[model samples]
Target: MAGVYFYDNQWFEECPKLIGPTDHSFWLGSSVFDGARTFQGLAPDLGLHVARLFKSARSMGLAPKETETEVERLCVEGIRKLPKTTELYIRPMFFARGGFVVPEPESTEFCLSVYDAPLPEFDGIKIRFSAWRRPAQDMALTNAKAGALYPNSSRALREALELGFDNAVVKDANGNIAELATANLWMVKDNVASTPALTGTFLAGVTRYRVACLLRENGIAVEETTLTESDLCNADEI
Candidate 1:
């Protein structure tokens, strides 16, 4: 994995060891991050991804030292350091270094990593419905792209993979369809595309929003509404 990382006001070819045992983020999981992809010299919705990173930091109770524009600029600069034709995953992260049970907002630190990660070929994936469910808004930090929240998703994904499926379709607390364990969910039925409506249970991914817009612009009807397992079983495409 060829990559470049920017941390502590310097760029590094190797990922620097930035966290330790006592670090708030390492122990308490006070971290937030966002991923954006660049391929063939085009990065769609990079700005939106950067903006969401800051929002996630705030939601996680960490303060970001850099503005969204500055982070986005750093991302582009990092991309330029790599081959233009390489497909890359751009990740910007914020973590807290201080506080015991609660993270100190002033102890936030930031890092940016850009790495070669080719997009997966579209050889359709097998998905199974998972027993795991997303937490209600009050039960967890559902609004932020926080690392603490991923363990549940990891468990769901692991369960699916163990059952010979590529991914799992997770549900919200009410047992309504929420999303795939790793990404937003979408289905097509009767020539209309639909996704689970934003219900504060899952992150409304940047790519998902972009896809919805593109579909609508191309004369397809896209709907955001509550979805059920029955809908998934009957969908023409997913």
Candidate 2:
């Protein structure tokens, strides 16, 4: 695992800070966050990552402090702060502080923190069919990468793990497959690729976009359409 971390200029400190005595993010689950990576000494598709973060913040009505250019610079500088020879997983978040009682962005405080953790190795995942379905946009901020939505994912994952599976594949309210607990999913069929379109029920991931583009560039016809559990289990001979 790498041993370097990075954050914005605001949280560019030597030590971590305490948070969430009664934070709304902890209590009411009013927060949003996004993850992107840097590899081979460069952050691939960095601008898109930062843009998504801002989009996530706006989706949740949060006030993000850093511009895209500032975030881009900080990401690079953060890598420089780490040892030159180490591979790193860079994460940044706009969190809430003192965000209880009344959850207003003006009253909210924010910070960023990064740490060294191994990138997950998904050779293949054994997914369990989750009974816990995702909320509709009418009921939850399902489209945004909000902290509140994770509890459902966490519960589904915990249930799946208890049942001897690696992860949970949650369905939408109508019993359509949504995605894995964390990452978006793709199913290959007949030398072409297909994935669930970004309905209001799921976050369209940055990596997912890149992969689709790469596949399209390589002459594979990538289709954005709804996929079901049956579709995955029975993809035509590829």
Candidate 3:
């Protein structure tokens, strides 16, 4: 994909090889990243996404070298390098290069990649209930956007794809609906929108929060409560 990457105090037209096989992030998965999208010359919630990236870094015990303001500036700068009309996925990442089982906080390094990735059309997706469950907050780095957490989500997604579905609705350890494998789960019933309450098992995305706010502002009822598979099956929309 066509992109601009910022790494090691320089910008590259190509994605530079910044990590080795022995790097802590490569071997032990001590990495955190956040994604924001820029489309139609607008980037909504860019600051929230950037702030979450740093919060994730701190939760993963990595000390990021760039301030949140600096990271946001870099994202904007990277976005400017691409065509104004290009729909892009902007990602800022922090990874560790050293330490054994636990990553060395001082070994954290940061990079930003802005690439052409058009938003998918809303054709609606078919979803199946996955056998997998999200880890509890005490069981994993549930508070952070840590790289290690994605394997379970990928497994759920793969199983759904294999079963001829586009995505999977994953549940928490308590067997309540958590979210979709790729995004937050929402359902509409009698014009009311409801989603799973944030219980620390899944990441409550920036877009999800914004959507809830917008719905409420427009006089739509949005509820965050425990959801079950039966709720999904009975909903007017999902």
Candidate 4:
């Protein structure tokens, strides 16, 4: 389950072997990463994940050295290097290296790593409403999937677990559903499917996007709109 990883153009035989956590990302928490999956020898929406990584890196002011095609090829190459029939999590990360402890595009590091793991196959995830609200829009990394932003989510999920729930449901400052701790949510009611609109607070996941497409193609009415706490509590199913 452990192997060398690629960073820029070099292979790190031993991780954390790179020089200088001198990067402000180590101190200022200014890094962004994206996740995608390859299953059954097919990487559905792989391109979208690569595109998203670029967008996230751009938002964090880190320059991405890999083009979409390059990223996709690396993903395939990394997976092929693994044992046959293995499932895995594919993470690509980008970080800023210099500049006043504030994240800027210069001196960026593009790291791509793969870890063996099974894809999530939860029949359903239970949830408790979180008292903690997502960071405000004024926050620099609210919706960027940056490492710094995950602590807030982690704490909320921990509290939910302590309270005997399977997952936590985070709300924005406006008290609308943002997302679950680990995955986006969809609620089905009266033959309609609904998910929270991207209100600039949560990640609209790749799997969620594909599911929406399948539902639309099947003539299901899918609505992207604001959902209040009451909407979830009243739902027949989620």
Estimate, for each residue in 1-238, the C-alpha lDDT of model 4 and write its tens digit.
6544777576554665443666688878778888877676566887898888888787787787678788788777877777656676788788877877666676777787876778668786668999988877686466577898888889999999998898998888898998888778888878899999987787778888999999999999999989989999888788
Residue 81 shift from truth in candidate 4, angstroms: 0.8
- Tens digit of lDDT per residue, candidate 1, span 10-91? 9999999999999999999999999999879788999999999998999998988899889999999999999999999999
Span of 10 residues, lowest total lDDT, candidate 2: 1-10
Cα lDDT tens digits for candidate 3, 1-238? 8899999999999989999999999999999999999878788999999999999999999999899999999999999999999999999999999999989999999999999999789898899999899999999999999889999999999999999999999999999999999999889999999999999998889999999999999999999999999999999999
**Candidate 2's residue-wise lDDT over 125-209, tens digit each?**
6787899988888888876777778889999999989898898888888888788887787778878788888778888888989
Q: Rank order by lDDT, top first?
A: 1, 3, 4, 2
Clashing pairs in 4: none
User: How far off is model 4, as Cα RMSD?
Assistant: 2.0
Give each model a TM-score.
0.99, 0.87, 0.99, 0.91
Clashes of each: 0, 0, 0, 0
Most accurate candidate by lDDT: 1
lDDT score of model 1? 0.95
lDDT of 1 at 221: 99
Between candidates 3 and 4, the one scoring higher on lDDT is: 3
Query: What lDDT would each prediction earn against the true structure?
Result: 0.95, 0.72, 0.94, 0.80
lDDT, candidate 4, at 65: 68
Tell me how far candidate 2 lies from the true structure as C-alpha RMSD in angstroms. 2.6
